[model samples]
Target: MSRASPRYDRRVRLYDTYTRGLVELPPPPGPIGMYFCGPTVYQRIHVGNAIPFVLPLWLKRWLELDGYQTKLVINITDINDKIYDAAPGASAKLSTDATAWYIEDTGLLGLGRPDVEPTAVETVPDQIRTISALVDAGHAYESDGDVYYRVGSFPEYGRLSGQNPDQVEEQEPNARKEDPRDFALWKANKPTEDTWWDSPWGRGRPGWHIECSVMAEKHLGPEFEIHGGGLDLVFPHHENELAQSRALGHGFAHIWTHNGLLRFGGEKMSKSVGNVVSLREALDRWGREALLVFFLSGHWRKPLDYTDETMAAARAQWTDFVASVYDPSEERPARGWEALAEALEDDFNTPEALAILHEWRAAGQLELMKRGLSVFGLEIERVEPPAEVNVFKEARDAARAERNFEAADDNRARIEEHGWTVRDRPDGSVLVPKP
Candidate 1:
């Protein structure tokens, strides 16, 4: 298979968790195929779930703008223990409803959607065939109506997770399992489970790991450039996925790119941890712009603490960006664009890119600011206000010039009543649509 040459001659390097070092990507307009593991549709996803969603979308945006033809596939795990436990007999309905909510809430972020969004339930047949292949190849077995992957049979089993096969802790201990460390490839439908798909092993559902392995290959083929998800998936989930795909003579993901988890206070925010802040809540409270700025404030590969204070800071920063965009100042650092490219190229270091963006803003680089912010979907546009609103703004400016503080305040209130606001900048006051 031949890869495409770079149209813009741009390249990016990412820290592959599997390789434990930096890895340069193939050249662009690569038609680079990347897979991302999205959330299980058990309930409303938290702001933490948005990290993997946002990071990869931004990466795609950046790469495509830099001349890469990229295919980004984010999968929804509709069949999981969490979904079954969260809704029991009505799990299918919950998965359907929750999947819609997941789409709606993440869609609010305004980052472009993935090229393909595959669902786990839709890939059951492929999963069953892969499991059968593993069984025939002596890498898996059927026991008690369940299928388990043979951990010791695959010599490279723990290479990705850095866990010794012998010392690996029990995943799901079953007396019928060939080894305690072996994990399920197919889980036999329990009395508690209402959703079941028939396979050679019996009426069962695909294991979480196998679902990803099948869905990823179904869309991106056996060998793809990158597989992405939250940093926490490095253990059993990704390791098991890697083992399953490779056992069938597939190369699997060349780079395991895991974005850092979003933490609340000092702990990871998860429904299990009970510190979850729903994405809907965050979008409603802080809005999409502030939430995006908050995401950009931290490097994608590092933990970012979610706090009211941090959100407030992001809001303030977004306000400044909005104001800075319309400023007429032409002064800009000569290396501004180069600096941004260098930062992102080094390892998709968004935090560094953001810092350079602020420098562009501080130096009054309006065009540069627009170019950079567009990469992250922070769209800024200059709009002409209604004639009546402009009249109020003009009145406000006149009152301020004449030292009529009372009249100035009244004009400000009038401007707000018209659903617009005045932003006072160093150049002068400007009319902006209220955020």
Candidate 2:
């Protein structure tokens, strides 16, 4: 863990060959057990579903800045189908305490918290002891009270979505499923929705792809290291969670990645396409550092596109990189902040690490643009302004001394649209904006 700490660089090969469609798969050789596919809270999580919570919190903070040693888990399905269609009351203590209160409302959505969440109704007895050891090794089946999985008993079942469990069993089944490429792992207790209990396949629940193949084999085991989410769940939810962790013989994730999909004008962003928004209303109208510069402005596999002019150009490029790092202007130009630590050590090439942070803030170099905004999480800091902008510039100088020029031009355009700048003079006194 100390190879001269650049966090121990040189790793990043990355995968997602469009979800291993060709089956290459190889990445986790040392400490990297990730697993994301979380959240099914039936409501309020949007920011394009927190783009699978910031691409596994930027692949667990860029694989702990490359030194690895990550664990990462993020489960929480809370018994599927959008929490049984928004909780149609049933228990495992009400879908595992309502999906741990919708994943603590997504750890208050700034995306840095989750290390282990685990739900699917507290891993339904490890998904009924992993579908009773894949139905006593025949790779699963039950039928009426439901259990399934047999997509013709593995055989590299469509090798992660290249698709052909005999063409997904010639496509058509899905009534309660049996074999249109058999899926569910448990589900029987239907007196009319949600249910639970030590299942043999009776008091139902636990089937959305064996709750992340038994919570990634009970917390990142049976091989791990990267299995990210949302390139529209890479074909049939990570190819049926890689056929339920290779029908329980282990080895399901070894670099899968998947980000790309938060579009708006160019379409996509669905809540059945209402063009959904809500990362708690874009953090109550743009705040968590302009929602992490609108989720690091693209290339976590690509397709960005959201708008109100791309979140007012990512809140005017995070207010001109925090007013060019609080522009005190001592004229310190030399910046080459180790070329953004050599472009975030390549592979996390955030637009070439924001073009080495606009060539270190166009060379005025505010300490190499605050160490390239602290390795691209966008370092922030300089915000001040809210004394309510000097109480709206002393009520915009008592509304231009009561002549009330339209209430002093609406508190001088709301303190110059909250970034501030106002001056009125002619002895009326207003002046503010001088960060």
Candidate 3:
């Protein structure tokens, strides 16, 4: 294994499921390939679903800052049982619409789209080829028009999941499977399903786990730097992907990083549970900066609970941070910036990095504050209000001074309508552009 670059040696330590420990990502000779599991586009994505999606974007930013070219791939699972069940005859349209919404909603968070986004429907041939290879190698079996991976053929079937093969329970029980633990590589066409693709096995669709393996390998090659998803997928979903890929004599992924799921009302926020807070809804109410603050408040590897009070706190903190951006200070404070970078380097510890930003702001180190925010992808540009804004502020303040409370309130409302906010200070009220 290559050692991490000197610039990122202390940072970029990630947990690897295959090794069952923290591993350093070595400096890449070429662009680093990162594949993160994306949404199965049956409907709108919620904040819970956004957690894992946002993680890779954040990692990509950090990697770029550390001087590594990164090629990020987040696949769209257009072909799935859920898509058919949700939209019936309109499955393809539903997937396309949901994918567009996913792009728009995540764009509001200020993280741009991934470099590559391959759809399962577009990669059917790749999936078929992989399944055919596994079968030719005796690692999988075809029975009753359905293709199932032979769990007994791969010795490390349960290694990623930390489950003994004997103790693992069977999922999607099929009578034709040679072993009960075997999982489907291709599901036989069903009368109730809406979409079908012709494959060597039969006219059917790719399995949920198999789509990701094929898509990731097709875009990033057999071996890649990182494969990431939610902690919930550590079971059969990711475990199956690992088995089939290894059986094909491929390296698959160097590290398997899973983020903790988001929760609401003490339950995992999911579409099935009907406890989801959609990304659009959250962004509409709290705005992007506040929502991002809420997300970064907790560690990425631990579960985050969504509550009104928590969101309110994040809003307040974001407001204060933005206010501090307008604070005038001349000092650069090199030590504070070094501390911020060090905190980020230590496994992307964002909370600690945020604390350092707070410290810099308290000390009136505007340069350091800017540096910190830039690293966190929270940088805000300073926009000076036009002459008309200053005139309105003067009129509003004069009305307040004259004890014309009614006039003052009206002036304040007009100022806000003009797309600026009035912040009252001991000396006077300051006008800032609405965030």
| Per-prediction TM-score to the true structure, in the order listed | 0.94, 0.38, 0.90
- Candidate 1, residues 1-435, lDDT tens digits: the string is 555544335568999998899998887677788999999998899998999999899999988877788899999999999888989799999999999999999999999799999999889999999999999999999999999999999988787888887788789776988789899999998999999998887798999999999999999999999899988898899999999999889998999998888989878787668888999999999999999999999988899999999999999989888866554455855465778887898889988888888888888887888899999999887778899999999999999999999999999999999988897877678887776
lDDT of 3: 0.83
Runs in model 3 deviating more than 4 A are 1-11, 28-30, 328-334, 386-389, 395-429, 433-435
Please give the RMSD to the true structure for each candidate, in Å: 2.5, 15.7, 3.1
Candidate 2, lDDT over the whole model: 0.68
lDDT of 2 by residue, 1-435 (tens): 536645234345555543543232233335777788877755656777676776677656755654556778877676666655665674345555655555665566545676787777667787788788888888777878877777776777776557656776343256766567677777777665746675766677767877787788788788776787777776777877788777777876766777788888899888786778867677778766666667776767788887788888878777766665544334645645555545544545566766566666766667667765664355656556678877877887887678788887888788888877665445544343343
**Top-scoring candidate (lDDT):** 1
Count of clashes in candidate 3: 1
Better of 2 and 3 by lDDT: 3
For candidate 3, write residues 170-289 as lDDT tens digits: 989968988899999999898888779888877888899999999999999999889999898888889998998889999999989888888886787876787778999998998888
Candidate 1 worst ten-residue window by lDDT: 1-10
| Worst 10-residue lDDT window, candidate 3 | 327-336
